[model samples]
Target: MNISPTDFASLLCSRLCHDLLSPVGALNNGLELLADENDPAMRARCLELLADSAKASANKLKFFRLAFGAAGGFGDMVDTREARTAIGGLFGDGHRVELGWMVEEETLPKGAVKVLLNLALIAGDALVRGGRLDIGAETIDGHVEIVVRGEGPRIVLDDELRGALGGTAGDTITPRAAAAHLARALVTENGGSLQISPPDAPALMFGAVFNAA
Candidate 1:
């Protein structure tokens, strides 16, 4: 789809705001409650709620910094450890999803890292009922190959996301599908290919391959 850079950026910003609204709003509400509740136990509960919201907000920001912004300094390659931490922080709370990191490479090209993280984001979100998320990547034959898999009792990969990943979402792209669109665009720009498992399959899988930096 022909989208101006500014428009694409606006879409991403909208997505970020939507995802963060809940936790940030909770923080605001928690603060207000803490101020009103004079009871020690209630005030303590408020503090706990505030803490959880703060952590969630921080985790999302960290993940977005790498997945959607210029994180990992001004380098062409980023450490895989940082990526692992970001993903862990995003899903580690309450064990909503289990994460398996299988990337053997110490570092990867920035474009490859962004694509990998975004694919993981999509796959993780597909597990609406909580599930296992496995992310793996490696460089072979001068190409970096990345794969994200999600398995659970129920998986929901919406049509909009599928269309975005396939570059067939057409003219109207919702904020929710922005990550998929960004991943597809990056892979195409790198002369790479993206593959999504059949929607009816038992599990959901996303794979992408691009030249190594």
Candidate 2:
């Protein structure tokens, strides 16, 4: 990519800022609650709020440290097992985001992992009523594909998300949308295509395809 040191640093910092935005918001909320509270009972509640927020932030940090952070270590080939686990962990104990492995040992760039994880997180948000999610990838005859599917009651397939996935212009994406947008950009940067849609089959799908040129 011939990226300069300054550009890469800026990218890394921007990525961190995007991910930590939520935890930092929660931190602010906790501080507000602490300030408004009185008495030992209320103080204990505030402490619990602070603790929970801290734990959530910590979990995200640990997961992102591997998925996006340098700690997972950078490489052209990313471990499928590690990427799957990292995404699942970041989504946490609520929704059921399943990985249906078809092609084992499929490897992609580190940025690919980060993008997929972020997209899955957005899809998870869309399936608020709890549903089935499918995550898998394949590489055949110099071609690669990754698919993320969600099936549930409500599928939040909005315009902004579609624009980001389709590489079109749209409103400024929120933190949640940033994941999917970045995923699309990552895939495109690698000469791949991203397609996202809500199926009449009651599914929300995010798929990417890369062909050796």
Candidate 3:
């Protein structure tokens, strides 16, 4: 519960690395195959696979930069469009998941953006069967409210992640739950609350409210 800044940073880095490993590894493998393959058609296919892997790696890095790192330069506010693009690129490539962006504001506080992106990451991951992801954010009465919903034939949200999102994970936080923990910590630090739907619920949803001040 009381993780030092350094420890939290390490956890976040671990999570990013874990998420990137698959795509990055694929890129490496694809490159190796491309170099050794001699058949013309097969070589072209290897090139296509390399391109796909490279694109996936790039997309994940972009998403993680905004979700886990300082990506919007020195500004206190971040463009909502960037967030939407990052989310869309991360999940829209294969067309396996549908993205719905409902944020009307052109920009949002950097902290709120981070919370929204991390919550979106969790919700997107919950859609194990590749479902629809809806993300919305708004500022009203000096408070920023964020919501993320994932709906599909089957949604699975791990108990640890749910607990982390609700700020009830205590000292059992792991790299897999780093994003959820980050979202909870950001909301709490901003004098707000984070909520998560029950695991057995038909759909998985995340809600967070933070003081805009």
* Clash list (residue pairs), candidate 2: none
**How many collisions between residues are there in candidate 1?**
0
Q: Which candidate gets the maximum lDDT versus the true structure?
A: 1
Which residue pairs does candidate 1 place in steric collision? none
Clashing residue pair totals per candidate (backbone < 3 A): 0, 0, 0
Compose the digit string of candidate 1's lDDT tens values, residues 1-213.
Answer: 888999999999999999999999999999999989999999999999999999999999999999999986665799999999999999876858999999999989999999999999999999999999999999999898999999998999999999999887889899999999999999988889999999789999999998876
State the weakest 10-residue window (summed lDDT) of model 1. 70-79
Model 1 segments more than 4 A misplaced: 73-75
Model 2, global lDDT? 0.67
Residue pair clashes in candidate 3 = none
Error of 2 at 163 (Å): 0.7
CA-lDDT, candidates in order: 0.93, 0.67, 0.88
In model 2, which regions exceed 4 Å deviation? Answer: 1-52, 66-74, 95-103, 171-176, 198-201, 211-213
User: Candidate 3 regions off by >4 Å?
Assistant: none
* Residues forming the 10-long window of minimal summed lDDT in candidate 2: 1-10
